[model samples]
Target: MTSTHATGEIQSRDRAPGELTLRAAWRWWLPPALVALLLALLCRDPFAGDWDALDYTVLALRGAPSSMLFGRTLFIYTNHYAYKLAHALFRVQPEHAYLLFKYMVICESPLAIIGMWAFARRLSGSRQTATIAALLLALSPFFVIYSGQAMTEIPSLVLLTFGLALHLRGMQERQTSFVLLSAALLGLSVNVRESVALYGLWLVVAPLVYRWKLDARTLGLTVAACALFFVCALGPFALIYLFDVDGYRAAWHGWVASMHMEEAAHPVTPYNFLPLAFFFFVAAPIVFIALPFAIYREWRTRGLSPLFALALIGLIANLSLITHYSAVINGRYQLTGLPGAIPLVADFLLRRAQARGRDLRRAFWRVVVIVSLTALIIGTPFMLFAWPTIQSHALTKEYRARLALLPDDAVIMAGGQTVAVTYYRGLGLGRWDVIGTGGGWPGARLPELIDAHLRAGRRVFVDADARLWFTDSWRGAETRQLVALQDRYHFRRSADALYEIRPRTDATAQDEPHLERLLAKPASKLRSLVRH
Candidate 1:
């Protein structure tokens, strides 16, 4: 830690007669540098988890309906476009989209590292504080989790960091382009993931609230720029919605309706964000010390920064928890606030060291840098080793296990894992009728669908639990009868102890003539809000 002025304004550092040497300058970047290298080496495999949604979206882009427009489109379609663009130019394979997505994600780590360092440097006016902030971000488990995976979380976070960095600079510089670019980036971030829109609100309001004396022209410019970006960003989605109005409505309504189901829900806990700091001694050790100190210091001097950042993060997190009752509360959600929080954390810790009359500033910095590197060395294996495997089970199984048991032409009567199923479609498995929830087929419609498929000679595969099947009562009988119809069908386990059934006999072939004929024709794609 190095001392700096109490105000959150960057000040020029004047080194005394005996400053640290050339080799010591390495401390500024070595931590993230090493983490990047070690992560690349340890986890070379395309991240297997949660690749489906992004992958499917990429696939959609390859064959997006001409009717597709932006706002009406889902994340899946947007992701599809990103990949399609890359594939058209980069000549990459679809299965390998995760590879590209991973690189894009990992690439953001360095950007985040640089941005945090710059933001901190601007605020605290201490190179050391900037370095500390960057190091903390690099070693954080939460960011690293998404950085190496194919999910949109990291990309969204990266854009957010970029937007905030630009917005902060815009406030200071009052440059029109900077403000417009910031607004555009914020809009882009929201397009990538709706949750990020919360940060956009933070960007727009926090500044006006904190610095109420803005000139009328600057304020007008900022507001106009933001409005322009918002309209442009949302225009495509709006068009897509117009083209597929009913589909979007159905998807939205179905999602809301599923909220009442008891078996699949869980509660949100605020304490869930602990692991980001708890796991890595290198990165989180600093955050643990810095976060509280920053909050306290900001309360005394820079009140709005802490209040705004914390409020935004806490609000987004709690909202996510309440709506989903999910246990996904993690540090990634806090990425939006990192820029503001980092400087506060850095300044507070550095001030304390100065107040204590510590002459060990250089040594403390070296230790912080060294420890950050060490935490990455320690944490990389778990991320590379355990993370992919864990994610594979959670996110990749459906993507990788397409050939598990079913033939390519077998019509699956299930929901979820659409991308994985589509990926494995090449294995000769038939397209899924996708009964239940986001598949566009509700459980209530399942009995008719199942009978229709059976009458058409289409071998319908169902989950052993038949969780998605429509029944007046919850009973194992429906699935049991369905299974019995197949004199010889294959059963294989899927995640969470569910089994998939595939026909094994000609009787299965003979019993459902109508299904075969209907399924034999190209399946019709009805526009609907797809759950990714």
Candidate 2:
């Protein structure tokens, strides 16, 4: 009898804490499904607005000579490399670049979701709570807004989350390999996006949450893991800089100078970091209101996941500070840290609701659900509806209509319409030979380069009224009249005056034989991107 009792007790202890039977596993699928549904709905509209920098980046990826642009930023290299590899493997088609972009988002987004689920499961200690946290991340309007872009933030978020998850797992199991894996992830995260600089620091700085106890050996091992991670992740870039000293110096100086100028100017007021900080940080009430309450409720059952909490606060606060210093208040820059933040917030809310057991319990849960649902309802329009509708959102339909009227195989002097031109050509709507001037590519020259293309009998498309490209008065009224009189090129009414110029003579026609050959290829046989 004594032996049987001992065996029974051992068996019970060995079983997992929570019973995740088939029914329970099925329930876990709910949140991820909802997340997928929401992202699909938002991406239904074509990506909008012409972001000039994005155009230049995409152009570089599409066979624009690297020698023509400066050395890549941390982000630029990752995005450029990813796109190039994807293109090479699949034979990148101009007509399917948008599809290619969509494939990247759809494929990489799951990493963040999985990361959130793992982080939540570890922190909350309940599969149910973790599922809710993962769902919240998937359903967030902020995430939905960014998931379809050809940007590096989402991938960065994935790396950070994965790193955090590995760290948590290592701590739980007392495993050295997991710790090293975490460090490797943190290293990769920093390179993937510079904003993850904060996350890398947090790994070193955040308090170590010891469930049991730690000796000097454990501490030393942890520090060694961090050092190894930094070396592994950053070694390649360091070597590149060491060998290419002049190039690295020039790129760094130019980048820092541009960033400083942008910060000093602070052109975007009202919406910059100072204001958004309230929504994300200081008002802490907005993002972290439930944190303390959840901490209190779980205090008896589970002490706060202190390291994760501190990491959350540090990453967010740092991002807000950086955002304030930027010229514009772009929310996407902080997205790399969001994979971890969403789950922390969600777990807090769910735990608080679960704690209030009897008195007004229904009302309390109702309120929690209402606020979450309200955030989605109110935030959706801003992220999805309004964003895509703005003329500056990406490229307005107006720009597309105007660009369509130009010759399909003409070299054009373009500065501002790189994004629009890229999208139109990538979509098979039209193809124009592009000679980009502004927005800073590697070998970008001024009007001298434009002169070369134009003098060689190529059609030129100046930014009819773009002050950034020419002297303020150059694109003024008289210039518009002069462009019209100069021959077959004229500014057609676009959504916002994106000019469409055409060849007026055959002398200009023969200048782009390569463009003619590409144009002759059927759109159907062009790149068939695997869209998500």
Candidate 3:
């Protein structure tokens, strides 16, 4: 009877001091969500970027683009449709659809933060580490900025984080339901953004690496789960096949062709580190600093690293792939795997803080203060108020002016970077025929396309801005085509960033005197960014 009583007592002792209950979870999650929502609301008047154009196009689409989505799959249409539902339900316009999307994105911020916290707590068994990880990632610049926009990255990160948290819980409790739910979430994340499929690597590697050997039954179960994940994430698209299998498959082939390895403009190199630097170091330096230590600790602690192995693998994969495949990589492309790495880093730092704080309370508090301040500064859109970079939110004025100058009826063939302005212009004018210079994909063959459009009695206006084509996307061909198009149509610069194709050669460029002062604002912002 005494032995039975002692066994029960031991079991009770093992019931974690702060298990993730509904109330406890809400406390950790609620504040960050509110703050994120508030900030997102303040960042109104839809910022100019590729996502803005893409969202606008999606809003206007009558149906899905077969198997081709954001050059991956048609899953992003889900968010677009969600916003469309909002537009219909709320009786808001296309512009306001973005606002609705941003607000919804903000809602996920808390889930991401609290999810990170819960996962960290589970992994490291430390509440302090969880808190720091959650807070740091919540206040990350990339996460905040993307969340404030109608973009896919934030949702992907949020879903991925929450999925990891769920997966950890499922394993800890040996519950099959939680594991299935976790798989579902991770699958949803990939459909939200294809790049996030990188994190899906963990699903395969985790079971194998965490336990050196597995029985046939377990292996079979793992394969079945993966099949379920694919079906959940992408099987719904099977409905598309119910309509036109040939068209969908062709479109799928086209998108796949673009990603062919040899066609890339650049080679991968040490420059791949940019994502790690831009996404993590710029926003949360402490996380970046603690990564090595975290790796060491996980390695030493009986391969405990598999808990966050997805994060590490995903980050590396993002950097490597983007560097090799993209014409010019943006920090946003690397975001999907970023939050995954933070919890590990946070735990490592928190453990050190605990070690040092054993009789040094004031020093410990000072360290906390510094870390908090750094995160806040990094997360804030200080560049909008202070930088000359394109990321600066103040440049919406320039985009707006460009949109205003373009004629409603003209078939605008503009540069790549000018997509945001062109898309918004087309949306406002109820025209969606705007095409990209260098023909977007056909390059020099754009001249023939232009000839055909002209033959069809369309007023084709060539507006290629060499300054706007910053990336190494089909370099020489685009430059030649730009010259050919300009020679064919007398293109004259109008306003600050707009161009007009005139019938005669005598047309002089119209000037916008206000552009100089407008440029100054962002220039100042860039200066501040550099100073920081």
Best by lDDT: 3
Ranking by lDDT: 3, 1, 2
Model-by-model lDDT, in order? 0.50, 0.50, 0.55
Q: Can you give the lDDT of residue 188 in candidate 2?
A: 70
lDDT of 3 by residue, 192-282 (tens): 6666666666667766755635878657657766776777566655655555543765765565665452334445556545543554465
Q: Per-residue alpha-carbon lDDT of model 2 for 1-532, expressed as tens digits?
A: 3322332332343247444332345455455745654574456335522263345355435433122122324445555566677778988754445456554655666557666666666554545445656665565554665565555555666777768777767767778788778888777776656556556554554335554345686668767877876775667566656676435555555656665654544454554544444334322233445654544543534444543454355456445554444312344444454554555455455444444442223523454465567566656544543452332434433456666656676554444455566656655666676654332331323345545666787665544434223222212222233333334332333334334344444343322111112222222110111000
RMSD of 2: 10.8
97: Cα error in model 3, Å: 2.2
Query: Residue-wise lDDT of candidate 1 within 279-333, one digit each (tens)?
Result: 3222254555556656755665655663436333534533343343322323344
TM-score, candidate number 1: 0.67
TM-score of each: 0.67, 0.65, 0.75
TM-score of 3: 0.75
Better of 1 and 2 by TM-score: 1
Ten-residue region with minimum lDDT total, candidate 2: 523-532
Model 1 CA lDDT for position 89: 97
User: What are the clash counts of all predictions, listed in order?
Assistant: 33, 13, 7
- Number of clashes in model 3? 7
In model 2, the runs with Cα more than 4 Å from the true position are 1-26, 44-92, 205-207, 211-214, 245-253, 267-273, 278-304, 311-320, 323-328, 358-368, 389-418, 421-532
